[model samples]
Target: MKKILLITILSLLFFSCENLDDGIKNSNSPNQFSQNFGQSVQRDFMGQVVDENNNPIESAIVKIGSNHVNTDSNGVFILYNVNVFEKFAYVSVEKMGYLLGSRSLVPTNGINKIKIMLIEKAPITTVNSGQTSEVNLPNGSKINFDGAFEDENGNSYSGSVSVFAYHLETSNSNISELMPGMLFAEAQDGSAKVLQTFGMLNVELAGASGEKLQIAEGHTAEISMKIDNTQLATASSTIPLWHFDEENGYWKEEGEATRQGDYYIGNVSHFSWWNVDAYQSMTTLNVTVVDGENNPIPNLGVTLTDQSGFISSTLTTNQNGNVSGLIPTNNSLTLEISGAFNYQEQIGSFNSNSSITIVISSASVNTFNFSGNVLDCDNNDFSNGYAVIAINNYVDYAPLVNGTFTSSYATYQDTFNYSVYGVNFGNNEFSTIVTGQADINVSNTVSINDLVVCLNSNTINLAGDFNLVVTRDDGNIYTFPNEIIQLVSPNNYKTTTTGSWAAGTIAQDQGYNFSINNLNGIIVPNQGLCQGYYSNNIYGENYNGTSSNGLIINNNEFYIQYTITFNTGPRIYTCHYIRN
Candidate 1:
């Protein structure tokens, strides 16, 4: 029994040991299997990010192959845990306000250390200030701007301010919204710094400035300052500066005023007041014409009248609905703009010393007194027809449709009758015609002294059982019967029968003679043939006496088709008659 007890104990201990061994084996087997199946891929990359000033940028993003990483506070970034022998990877560094940088690196056996330096991004400088100061600089020279910052009440700010300078390229005009120049410097201090190495200079003021600026030559060097935020008004003044003339490669400052080949340099600030006497003076005038929507009117005719009869000129508005011109001196001026649709005349006077814009709206008063009617060939009114009435000349072959003749004169009538009011009578040609209709009158050919009425009629005639025979001076007789006739005549005529004739008979056999006569007389022979007869028998007595069947009629009994050859003269006629 003791031996059995020992064996039982031994057996229990062996089972316990086996359970422990199984647990250990299971854990160890899993670890060994994972070691054989899984693998760790490490990807390493390094790069740097900087600003346009070549200063290191922090918190930049770095991308290696498919892995992404960000730089610490020092603008350094790296990627790890990448497969070394898998494939070649790329390193990219990205930062705001800096150009993106990228590089390729092939992983070796161990940790791959790649150093990438990112380039500074190009600066983006746009002109957001309304106050533009253009400075002309000498070639191969530079300009440094130094100015003090002040508040709206002329108090200086105590904090460090940012300063920016722009070199105005050829594309930097006052009308442009973009500043196409190299950024000279962006300094955080209040000291002066050079902005551009060449071309014109434009300074942007961001911190402070008073309503007015005081600039002196000796007290301060050539400097540009930021105007006060309260004084940051959109209103601007233009001061024209004279150019420095160079002759034979030498600077010539004398007799610069009368030179023909002169150019402009820049604007005159408060510092330029010392040389204000020698500054070439110019007067600027701003002109603007607008429609009812206040949109700029393009291709407007502008006239400036002084003592001279009239100085006529034309100008088109810019995108800002304004036009500018420079005058030599100040004088009383009257501005007139013609050829504006739905716009009135805008006239005013001002001292032409500074840039000014003249805004012209539609005229308040209607001008010109005009009246006319549009009539058809039958002298009937055209009910819904439009007429285009031009004063001087006809521009188009067709009448103007939906077009305004003047500010107050418009034609929308099928039958037009207008009394043009307040018209300044000059050498004017009045041409009025209906749209899509034949021109009834050509006033361009008529003289101002003779406002004669031109009457034109187009006649369509049906053969009225009468044969017409035309006897020409050459003794050639042309006959027409049972045919439609088209004739143009000044005096419209109706068909009338003169002699009695029988039915279904040739017109020449019928006792009827027709004649056509003009003012000159005997244009066409009085000859016609009737096809039917009409008789009014009284008391059943047939008064069928042949009333001279052979008739010699004069040039008055018959109406003939005719066309006018010329104006102010007798109409030439070509007659057609019927003969059997």
Candidate 2:
């Protein structure tokens, strides 16, 4: 960093506080007044003081009309016994190393809490060019240049230099004036006009739009300063150039200028204007959009906006997924890109003369539309229940009226398609065909019109206990409460406590449907002399492979044929065995 000379141009503007509110009692001095408003009444006011950076300024002096106080370590201050009728009052804040802040406060319902932000004082600069120069001035003030002059020959000119500091106005003043009640005196005859002997030259505002020559927001204000000397300047040295910040009401040192022949070039961030003692150009910006696979993704919308309030433009990517246009180089730029429904939107920031590529992830969107019917075991329309379809954990429901239902976006898929409808519970009002397979793909419209969902009306009561007898191969018999066996339920029409095959008590209302308990204690008469007691036709093959196989003795309609292989050959033994 280079140490350059900086001068404060303080133009103080004063506001008229002459007319005081009638409700408020006036004192000769602003700092002198009664602690009480009237009638022993008091109104409290609280506030905080901070710098432009939002850091709290502790011990700062705060004045609310006649009452004054200093902020604590937390930068908080309070004023008590304020006149309630006074709608507004002047508040002045002062702290070292910071510019003074003053404003008017309007109390609501006799109370108010406020936050005051104070701007830091611009650093005073000293100039040393073989000869050193320093301006002796009072504190809390800035210097303003009245005018600049030069001889026709462009040689060093000498004249009287007059500087003035203006006071900020209270009544007619506005926030735009950084410091309130501050101004400079008018330059007089024989005043020191020419501070130093320097040739006059031109400082042009590059990239300025109109006759007003204002720099656009988000665009840099290029300042080109030409020195009368024919010698070319280099970046190794420095030229002092400052940009005025309207918000902070101060002048700040701009970046170093690049030397080109007799001209020095510098860039200003914004148009609030610049006082340069610098020149300018920028180029086209190109943005590319690609997928996570690094392949070009075309037809994406890209917009570039200047952060400094410059004009913004939008363009669409070409087949190559690239968009290019002339963009501002005077300031920072922001890029916004958007693409297809599945891809995510992106925003990026870049500097001047920047061209970059953005990568986005391609997302897969899957949605399923279902048009199906809900039916009972007899293939009859089931109208009492609602229709529900779940795909990949995303479920959509519709009312089942007249056995028909239609749902949309009711399914999602990844890798493969799997969906179900109206078949959530094992104990349902109608038999359900939950294992039906439907072949479908993602992002495609598939009609599930043939999806015939069945309902099962079986419900088991686990509170009651039931008994079952099992005969093992060793000829040992074991009796147990149905709860002791796992996964032993018989059919889709029967409900079990376990989702898999399990032995459990059946509800009284449901047990009668299967009538498995009737087989208990029934004796079988031996019909032949071959061996063990056997009945000709008893056990049926209907419940053979179901959970009810071990418990149900017979279905009463078909006889069961048991095939036993003795390792030598397949021996088929058919018998109807009843429990005694």
Off by over 4 Å in 1: 1-284, 298-300, 307-310, 314-328, 340-562, 565-580
Most accurate candidate by TM-score? 2
TM-score of each: 0.18, 0.21
Per-residue lDDT over 1-580 for candidate 1, one digit per residue giving the tens place of the 0 to 100 score:
0000000001001001112122222222323322321234564333334333222344467665456765532233444465432222335566643334444323433334333444433322322122332332332112233443344455543433333333333222221111111111112221111121112333333343313233223223243222212222311232212211111100111111111112212322322111100221233455665544454544344545443222222333422444454332444555655553333343444454344455443333212222344333354443222222333321111111122121122111123232221110111112222222212142211111111122221111221223666443335555544221211112112233222322212232233222213232213223322322222110111112322112223222333433222223323233443421
Could you tell me the lDDT of residue 284 within candidate 1? 46
Once fitted onto the true fold, the runs of candidate 2 whose alpha carbons sit more than 4 angstroms away are 1-361, 375-381, 386-402, 405-443, 450-469, 475-580
Q: What C-alpha lDDT, on a 0 to 100 scale, does residue 388 get in candidate 2? A: 44
lDDT tens readout by residue for model 2, 1-580: 1101111110011111112123334343222232212233345565656654333455578876567887643355656566432333446788854555654423433224455666654433422212323233332222212123222343322333222112221111122223321110101221111011011111211111111122223434344444332123222344545443333222344465655554455665433333332211224455677656676655445655454433232344544566554443455655666434333332334344445777765453333345677666676776544444555433333445466765544112343444544521223222232433334443444444433434323322111123444343345554433321111121212212211221111122111112232232121121221122221222222234443322333322211223223324333322232211
Cα-based lDDT at residue 115, candidate 2: 55
> Cα deviation in Å at residue 97, candidate 1?
67
- Residue 568's lDDT within candidate 2 is 44
Judge candidate 1 at residue 366 and give its lDDT: 17
